[model samples]
Target chain A: MAELDLDSADGRREALRRMVTIRAFDQEAGNRFADGEIPGFVHLYIGEEAVGVGTCASLESDDYIASTHRGHGHCIAKGLDPKYMMAELYGKAEGYCNGKGGSMHIADVDAGMLGANGIVGAGPPLATGAALSIDYQDRDQVAVGFLGDGAVAQGQVHEAINLASTWDLPAIFVVENNHYGEGTPVEKQHNLDNLSDTAQAYDIPGVTVDGMDITAVAEAVAEARERARAGDGPTMVEAQTYRYRGHYEGDEEPYRDDEEVERWRDQDPIESFKDRLIERGELTQEEFDDLRAEIEASIDDAVEYAQETDAPEPSAAYEDMFVEQPPELERFANVARTDGGANGGDHR
Target chain B: MTAQAELEQETETMTVREAIRQGLREELERDEDVYLIGEDVGVFGGVLEVTGGLYEEFGEERVRDTPISEAGFMGAATGAAATGTRPVVELMFSDFMGVSMEQIMNQMAKMHYMFGGKAELPVTVRTTEGGGMGAASQHSGTVHTWIAHFPGLKAVAPGTAASAKGLTKAAIRSNDPVFVFENKMIYEQSGEVPTDEDYTVPIGEAAVEREGEDVTVVATQRLVGESLGVADSLEGDVSVEVIDPRSLYPLDTDTIVESVEKTGRLVVADESPLSYGTHAEIATRVQEEAFFSLDAPIQRVGTPDTHMPFSPPLEQEVLPGDDDVRAAIERIA
Candidate 1:
């Protein structure tokens, strides 16, 4: 590959800003979820920020992505507003799904974020479909599936890989292997040493990279996107990363020792990337401080916006059930009412 | 104009199979975004030959022949639907839905609603259902009732040649995901279809095939034919009204209720198993709406609640037939 101008000051600053925003958003959301202000289960994306930012930065807004339960970082990296995302978490009307879908189902179709699926390994097949849509529509866009190491065991993922390879679909499968599938290490769960070996079965190239290093992830994703655009087929990129926080907001680190978490945090992606940029003369300390300040301000604004947003009306539940009013809903509602009325008569 | 003149103006003759083929051909010609994808759908002309010669005409891209992986292809179809292409996936047989139920139940069915109605999955799954082909228990069975149970899906079963064409066209045009259950038995069955070439019947509506005064016969798919046969046989002694619910999910119970209100008796004929099936649902809805008008108890004629038997005699005994429908109608009348 030709030498890319990714080491520029603007590029480094943009990457840092995105990564910081993701971390801030995840932390804030985690706190809110713990306080009982947010509805539904949430999986924080605190430590895996670099992987999302680096991969998404290589593509355009027209490109597509299917995310996992731990999807806040992917949503931020793909350019979705944090205010609406937070509102969604709060189960307020201002949320992306109008409060119908909470944290696990957050989505903005206009931003090309298909959804943060509740089912494990469900994103791959949906991403494959999105890639097929792009190819069928005759566009040069590609679809990315962001999955975790735990999702590798799902049969749907293998089915998706086979389809993508056979049809030569414009798809990129990114596995953010955090070494643990909620506590069980990958070594104990599967027969293979690396998840990338699974990609070889589908006749696609697989690459492993340093998930903590945003630069390395960016290079891998850029190459995969290029190959997809050229109609070469799908690629699998595994990023070996870690999570600083527990899977959910209140999970105790009983399964793993605190020392392991501390070890991974010491090599934080944002700090490491910052050091590399300064060492290479790509960005100065003053510029980095300004970028950090800007990101903090953005996070503050998003929190304020979410806090002030109005809650959805109870009647809103009936809305968006279908594109048009389905007769089944009316019939079901009528049955409920009739059964209630017959039992109560005139009690009220 | 008189009602007779209007009927003459709207009627033409064709086979149910040709009507379906014409529906696909017309839609493909009308919309560039519409395409077909399934196993052996392109070159092999489909296993049942419902999609014959479409591959040669539309070429490889539009009429695609996929590998024998239902889960993979169905997922791709779901993705295509979300991204803007209106894909019609041929599942070949309704029994094959078991292999790709995740795509149908979890992904495609829930995406639009889960995304806060930001998306529309305008995909149609055309599959052959109902038993008559003697292909044994595995291949021949009516699973339309099973699909109708899902909230996000629209289940459609067309009984006539004209309805087969019109409803197929409407299903393709619908913004919601539609399951078009084409009975294997009705493909070769002939009737009067419109020659105008652009005719279509809207979903969520029922059609009254025969109007009478004594008993209302509610039927779907091939059972519509059996109901009509029984209706004809009982014309002199018992006045029977046959009502075909073309689309089951968004059921036009109002029409069925109206017929029952007039006739004051009801008999539901279905091909699925008796337990918690379409017949049970239709009966419940009708009783809710027109309970006072009923002169006799609401009756359902369907197969026994068991795995479809392979033995011809056992299958015959379990499946609801002309005799069972007639018995229900007679008891109600």
Candidate 2:
């Protein structure tokens, strides 16, 4: 309930708690997805927890962030309740999107977390646009766009960064280069060695940090936020991290060997951070265990709440398409309401 | 006042281009949150001159220009609209929508719905369409069908100067994302537009340009005027009725159905391609709503499934006009 102070020991403990919370939530989601409890595909953020938590730690609650398909960690880091996110994954009426947007599209706009985009490389433009809004209104705020390594190859990303730089808008482009974009390695996708080198093309400052180190990611974002607030335009930060799991729960990752995965796991962000905290006499092994247990229990409560929540009514599908339902959609809504959408099976 | 403004009030005769400019100027003055952003929209005063003199009035902050990046500006406008600002993005040409289709289809259209109706996108995308002036394939293609077919977005194509002014204002004020597809050929065409700043033609309503008893011709955009001309030439021979379905997506099916039920014969005309396009949607809705009242089969007048050619003769050869509407009416009536 206390305001976060990233500079203090207590704030570092809270950060560790958030990272653990993300890991537990995604772990449970992956297990349930494999067990057929969660429908649709889910892109887990198990290994990239520190990047999300640390990057968000550098931001104020009013600062905007646009996330990608791999967005659970970002949502959790942005302070969205886990119960509602779990309900969304379960396709329940109590979900963040009221069962409309499942895992990939979770959003809490009032919290300044733009909806997680389904389209790759789509977040940069939105974040840049948000920065444009900030500049237009003469507000002292920043907007950060969190994108994947694969998104760097997208044209819209280039346009977004160019526009942001040209206007000197207060926006930051944070690239989570997790070694691979889906099954393809990052090397195969981009000609450049360092993804942050992309900032050079737009005449903006760029930096690469150890994404596994929470402090490094936080420091880079903090500097970027500072420059942005000073009206120095955008900065690109590439967090070199890894995803421990496959791209999705059901992905059969034939691209990399087990040894490559083991090498990355050896530098696991959460475990390393916890070890450092204990060495500093700020935490003990028992305290860490208790923290993990507490987070696991909370995730369990989220799952139970999701299971008890009811599915949205069939007519709910046609409800959010517009602010006021026009006469044009009445015929389709009529059929969906009567047949429970069975007649329009092709639509799904 | 200038000659254009004098003409607007004296004879109430305002060109479509002038009417649209007036609407933008009024909205920009009414709401500080409303802005105009696009390529050449600031100092250049729009490539087609639709936004002329706006840059001088509103300045660069409001009438902002971009570096010819459609996807970036379109998505930025979408994001700006999601926030507190209302952005009216000029896409230059409808044919260029393919460059930014990802932002249009995935982000701009689906954000509000996917976000469980939490976000409101008061964004208006104004683009020009229609084949004329020898602008060739890229600049002259009519792509309103694509916007109309896509859900979570509204499409409006005005046929007259009055509807152009009214619909542009209405689209700017709507909470949902709206696309104003202006036919390039009709920009210079003049008509009597209401001088009242508050006068706005409601979206999703059909205007019976001229009513008759024997046959109904439902048309859109450039074809609306051509069909009206054909109806006039027919005089007493067929008693042809001409209707303009200004809004394409939430199409005025009731008005079309009523006209069809009374006339007993129908002809659907639009500038889009014949297959699975605007003509098909209008014809389908008419048959579904007024099937029993029809005495004759519905006829469709549209471009044969082909791209607009570069040659002026070839372009004219494929373009639908008053002759096509008259021929279709003759066959059905």
Candidate 3:
């Protein structure tokens, strides 16, 4: 696996492009959901792109990551093709999960993206387990579990961190504290102000970083990844981020005011990162516009591909239930395979 | 000699505990990715001593002990299985499944299907169940029915030491997640286990412990042995056939349905509760396939829908045994 060279101009440009791509992909997803083109609800990662891109920028090609429900940004950051992810969201056969998993459960294990889980706090344990596998296999790789602020209160998340710490497994936990866990505020959800403080209980290093700043998040995760690889166990890095969009696409968002959303929008991650790159002479304004245009076109192509793809056949429901599909399912499989209510059909 | 006869000739007489331990040891030796993780599974040789001497032989890395955190380790095992490794995790008691229910139901069981078949979880969860040693309600409850009923999980409850070794090996080798439900009381019961390391009893197959024409007794776990005993005693009068449907989920319905067709009378016996349990599932499948073959109404032999009491008499009274099997057989046969 090649070392992540985020400090290099090429690496920085690539990181910014990924963040922009995430924003464009999610923006398209939000519009599609509102237009009723996409079937299910979508939690846009529009505002929290930096957290995913920065944290993932610290990881090598073979390192694993388990993501939460708002997982499009992480999927993009982890190098999953936007076309396949969009196809999954569109419930098409060409999707990552073959239409079985929609917006919430897109996964590409071969790409080292474990999954975008629907169940909150579920990814941490999975990430820890992946770390266990890495340790057991004697691999020089680490695992990262990305969770939300709401997941901080979950007992299983703490259990995962504790287990990872105890085993000295190469795992890094980056808490994407996007202020609200669903609709509730972080303050009400947790007693501790800083979610990273929860790491102290496990006797591991804990730090908080500016999630809006990609560089800050990247540096923090890179350090944590180093510690993990050096057999220093797990580290908790809380990224103080905010989501500009509603919890879900159609959410009325009765919990928070418009003023808070506007305030968060003021510190837009992509805009600030683009400005930082221009200021650093790493990127020109014209170059940034070209990058944005290129990303927008790719997103447009992904949406088109997803729209053109076919829905999985009805019988596909029985497939992939087990490596060797069980005989008990065969009775039902026959019914599904039959065209109409002639061959022992309409039993219900 | 033929392969079957050759394999049979090299049999070793061992208890169920020893059979399971031998299976674990063979798998650990066979696959570098295979590891044992659970409470008291290492230095203490397992809580029930089922994994006795494994820790010494395999060392701490392969035979690892963990804190009594069921959800953590269970979730970790699921993750590890998905990443690449076969983790045979023990939950100490079947009752402890509640603590890790989220991981089992949401993560471990559904990962493959939910991920559109991209992920393969080669995880085996081994736990103890059944009532006999006065362990009371929590520890001794027969919960194999729950795991069997759960989607994406294959369950096996062995009735003999041979099936115990075979099923344990099969579960560990399986690419999908499997649960081996061991009856705590049967660990001491000795039987002939094939000495071959590669020997495995395929999942979704049943073994006809005894063959008869009068009635068919479909049983699981300790009840399989009990039904066999009842079949032996009622050889002349009832001629009871005992069929151990070891794998509960992908059940060998053909074997069970054939036995019911031959016998014409059915008695489903399991240590789980009578209603909405393993008995109901087996009964439903049998009646569905061999409805016309039944000469009489099917009878069920299992614990009444209640928890096992602490008292010896109450515990024994609530627990189903050979007497229950015989009575159920007499009613239908």
**How far out, in Å, is residue A339 in model 3?**
6.8
Which numbered prediction scores highest in TM-score against the true structure? Answer: 3
What's the number of clashes in each of the models? 0, 0, 0
Identify the superior model by lDDT, candidate 1 or candidate 2.
2
Per-candidate Cα RMSD to the true structure, in Å, reads 2.9, 3.8, 2.2
**Which regions of candidate 1 deviate over 4 angstroms?**
A1-5, A282-290, A331-348, B1-12
List residue ranges in candidate 2 displaced over 4 A: A1-3, A336-348, B1-11
DockQ of all candidates, in order? 0.52, 0.51, 0.64
Per-residue CA lDDT of model 2 for B177-209, tens digit only, reads 999999999999888888787767677877888
Worst 10 residues of 2 chain A by lDDT: A339-348
Comparing 1 and 3 by lDDT, which wins? 3
Residue-level lDDT tens digits of model 3 in A1-348: 333467788888889889999999999999999999999789999999999999889899889999999999999999999999999999999999999989999999999999999999999999999999999988989999999999988989988999999999999999999999999999899889798998999999999999999989999999999999999999999999999888999888999998888898888888998898889988899999998999999999999999998999987888898998897676866656545332242243
TM for every model, in the order presented, reads 0.95, 0.96, 0.97
Error of 2 at B275 (Å): 0.5
Per-residue accuracy of model 1 over B1-333 as CA lDDT, tens digit each: 111222354676778888898899999998989999998999999998988988998988899988888887888888778888899999988999999898888888888877778888899999998665566778877888878998788989998887899889988998889999998888888888776656777788888888889999988888888898999998899988898888898888788888998999999888888898898888887777677788899998887876667777777777778899998887867
Which is better, 2 or 3, measured by lDDT?
3
Docking quality of model 3: it rates as medium
